[model samples]
Target: MAVPQFQHLAGRVWVCPGDPDPEAVQAGVAVVADERGSVLIDAGQSPTHAREIQAALTAAGLPQPRWLVYTHHHWDHVWGACAWPGVEIVGHETAVPLLRTEAARPWSHHYLDEQVRANPRLGPSFRARARAMDSWADFAVLPPTRTFADVDELPVGVGLRHVGGGHAPDSTIVLVPDSGVMLLGDCYYPPPAHLRRPDDGLDLVLVRRLLQDDYLWYVSSHAEPMTAEQARSAVETT
Candidate 1:
């Protein structure tokens, strides 16, 4: 499949579509540009993916991001951060320790293959997704430089809120008031299959809370943007 290009969402927001292909998974990356500069929603899966996003932005004549925000500490959302050298990274307070833990992991190809050999249920899926990139030699997980508790408001009218959910305890949601859009970073998805645990109603609760907002569009990391009603229906049915 051809690499997806960043599509304009609304206002200053643009998104590069994510792929769910089992052989290689990728989370969508987005950017919100303002007079000050631009704030990137997620860094993507690898240096290659990050560069794809950069090329798309350059093709569209958009400015390089001034800040990079991780919606969570998930590998898919953060591994590409190293590509954006000087950009200040931000995440939820709970994500700090999680990222530190990730930074300590061995991301080499051999280590990943070993993990698959040790753990069957989860390892194969993980290894398959990691295959998205040709090399893991340059892979590094960079922790966020700035952390926030509940909400952090940026000068560009972008808001970051730490709303933990079933998918990840450090999950966060980004609100772009300028575009009336909310970026949902795998926050409503149920826990991984290996966890063997239910959301325990967290999905509905979070969806209800989110619907109270004035967002016109909700974009999940792995799926296309949705309407407020569509989000509500998705959560209720799931």
Candidate 2:
């Protein structure tokens, strides 16, 4: 597998390259730092990915993240919490139940089998990674140590808001006040049925409000960052 590239977006903010294949679910991890410490927007898909992120941070002269905030409880975003042993994991209260469900296992053979059948070209590489992940006997879901209902302040002037009913039941958005960047995770896009609710207009309204703010950059988990104007236009058209 190719090593993911981390790009610096602004002062003390960097984003790792996201999965290029739409069929794949891995998200780019956002790293934000301040004098106090650093904070990771989302843990990567696996322990190996998490370790690579750590190395990148060290190379960039940023401190190990003091907090790991999950945008949602999807397997690809939250599975790497095991890599940061002592980091204070934070997420919306609803994510706890989702993470503890039986479906939240570290590696799922059934899911891999389906992926192989669906996309023959990418199946082999996906299966190879799956087999490696299976060997991680110590892998387990690490529930967030701190849970919030609506809004919470995090280290480094970062703020988290639980924007319910979007990409995931516990979908949240991370805001960097200083840089005017907001990590939208997978919230402002087409989501799985189980993860989406009927009242999508409310979510759109919230998104529009955020975009209208002084935010300069809007970063999506699976795509390159967009300017506030581009974000607003996309949301309105979609």
Q: Pick the candidate with the highest TM-score.
A: 1
Q: lDDT for each of the candidates?
A: 0.83, 0.78
Q: Give me the runs in candidate 1 sitting further than 4 Å from their true place.
A: 198-202, 235-238
TM-score between candidate 2 and the true structure: 0.83
Task: Give the distance in Å from residue 189's predicted Cα in candidate 2 to where it truly belongs.
Answer: 2.2
lDDT score for residue 18 of model 1: 75
Off by over 4 Å in 2: 102-134, 193-206
Put down candidate 1 lDDT per residue, 62-139, tens digits, no spaces: 889999999998878988898888899999988889889988987777777777778876674577556756777667
Query: lDDT per residue, candidate 2, 114-175, as tens digits?
Result: 76688675564465457436446567777788999999998568899988655677889998
lDDT of 1 at 106: 76
**TM-score per model over all chains:** 0.92, 0.83
